[model samples]
Target: MLQSLTGVEKHNIEKKQAKALFESTLWSDAQTIGVTISRGFEWDTKHIIESGWEQGKQMVVPKCNPEEKSMQFYRLNDFQQLETVYFGLQEPKPSATEAVSPDQIDLLLVPGLLFNTNGYRLGFGGGYYDRFLANFKGNTIMVASQQQKCESIPVEAFDRPVQYVLTEEGMKQSK
Candidate 1:
């Protein structure tokens, strides 16, 4: 359903969602943020990254190690610090960006295809975020559209729920 959205509609929804996130206390209080460089079909995150920079917040992005199925976040100062990797996913260049420890992040923007009221998400199969979330103690949130909301989704023992969900309408604390 996300992929079928018209370009204009998608842009509008993304803008509204981003604005809501920007107004959030979580965003305001956070000094360091962790986010992914969004893909074509995903909700645009470029604006959020730029907004973080404009606010003088430290923005970090993940670089996945496919072999270990793990990810490490790196501080991103410029778009030039990213390089395309498998499946055209943009990842931080370790050589150009400094690694940031998980505990150092003040907020983490979790990504998913669908989310339930409980905050559990149906993430991409890799389980990279799942592993990362296992030990992460900071605030975690996901930006999603109403269309991506579901009544329920299958949950596994290892799944970690986000604390909040931000949509075009506003932010909601997950059950």
Candidate 2:
């Protein structure tokens, strides 16, 4: 459904979702945030990254190691610190950025293709986020458009539910 959105429609929805997130206490209270640089079909996170910088909050992006099926986050001070990697994903250049411990992140913005009200998500199938969440102690949240919401998703033993889901309509604590 996300792929069907026109550029204008996606942009407007993304802006609204971002605005809702900004108004949430989670956004206001988090000092350090972890997020991914979005791809074309995903909700754009560039604004969120910039807003974190403008608010004096530390922003971090992940670099995935395909071999280990793991991810490490790095502090991203500027977009110039990123390099295009596999599948055209923008990842933090290890040489240009400082590594940030998972414990230091107050909130993590989880990515998903689809989600239910319960917070269970249908991720991109890499399981990187699932593995990372296994030990992560910080708050987890997912931002999606209303179109991305579904009645349910297939859950596995390893699946982890996010604490909250923010959409263009508003933010809701997952059941």
What lDDT would each prediction earn against the true structure? 0.94, 0.94
Lowest summed lDDT across 10 adjacent residues in model 1 is found at 15-24
Model 2 has an lDDT value of: 0.94
* Colliding pairs, model 1: none
**Residue 17's lDDT in candidate 2:** 90
Candidate 1 structure lDDT? 0.94
Let me know the TM-score candidate 1 reaches against the reference structure: 0.98
Task: Compute the lDDT of residue 114 as modeled in candidate 1.
Answer: 96
